[model samples]
Target: MRRREVLGSLSGAGALFGLPAASAQGKAPPLPDAALAERDPERYWARVRDEQFLLPGWRAFLNTGSLGVAPR
Candidate 1:
């Protein structure tokens, strides 16, 4: 897999969709790199996991091959 695909998974899909709105509205602060894995790795990861879009019925992890390159 490509580096962005991996980082996107690590950062959360919500970051892609939600960040623009948050930036336009100036509501949320940017997360430091360490913040993603520092304080509580499990909790942070759980939140990131929740923010992604799953394949039609699969439980977790994006199936990029099925979805194609548009979203990527």
Candidate 2:
């Protein structure tokens, strides 16, 4: 099949499966409150790590330099 035909089929299949289109997906969760950070530093950082970043829960990403992964 042609590239366009393949893409069209995939798009239709995505719709049939009830997948959300790019624009339809809602915004990311808001950043945790500053007060939470001050009151409970561990809990605050956990929220930030879990909500802000897209890394898998099983993985540990510790490189925050120029080559670090950006937040999703």
Candidate 3:
């Protein structure tokens, strides 16, 4: 669907669901960096299982519309 159409639908659904306005959306929790693994297997899994998955490049991390990660 087109951007405007999709947004319009979301707005209608939001109202029907009694959700807050679009601007009142909740923020994604911060993700721990891959660098924090300290070169260990345990710490690596810690980030993978907990950190928010973000695509590489730009502010893809801030986009709530995406939940999958593309290879960096």
Candidate 4:
């Protein structure tokens, strides 16, 4: 495909997947670390996880296979 067509296809796919545009490009915003640490760690993390924008029509994932790695 041409460049424009490829870009359009990728953009559409991102929207269809329910991924926030920025996060879909691997630019996930940092969560508030201090606040999270002060609260119950497990409960705070569960709230953060619940806020993630996952693929459309999906409920939950049992593993990390679909998640991206942090930049080094």
Q: Could you tell me every candidate's TM-score relative to the true structure?
A: 0.29, 0.51, 0.29, 0.32
Over 1-72, each residue of candidate 3 has an lDDT whose tens digit, in order, gives 899999999999878777655435755666566576666768775466445444433443444477555322
Candidate number that wins on lDDT, 1 or 3 = 3
What's the lDDT for all of these models? 0.57, 0.83, 0.60, 0.62
Summarize candidate 4's per-residue lDDT along 27-72 as a digit string, tens digits: 5546646677686788676555644444332445556687642231
lDDT, residue 55, candidate 1: 30
TM-score leader:
2
Which candidate's lDDT is highest? 2
- Please give me the total number of clashing residue pairs in predicted model 4: 0
Off by over 4 Å in 1: 1-36, 52-58, 68-72
Q: Could you tell which candidate, 3 or 4, scores higher by TM-score? A: 4
Order the candidate numbers by lDDT, best to worst.
Answer: 2, 4, 3, 1
lDDT of 1 by residue, 1-72 (tens): 999999889789767888889767743333335676888898765554444322332455455578542210
Candidate 1 lDDT for residue 28 = 39
Looking at candidate 3, what is the lDDT of residue 4? 100
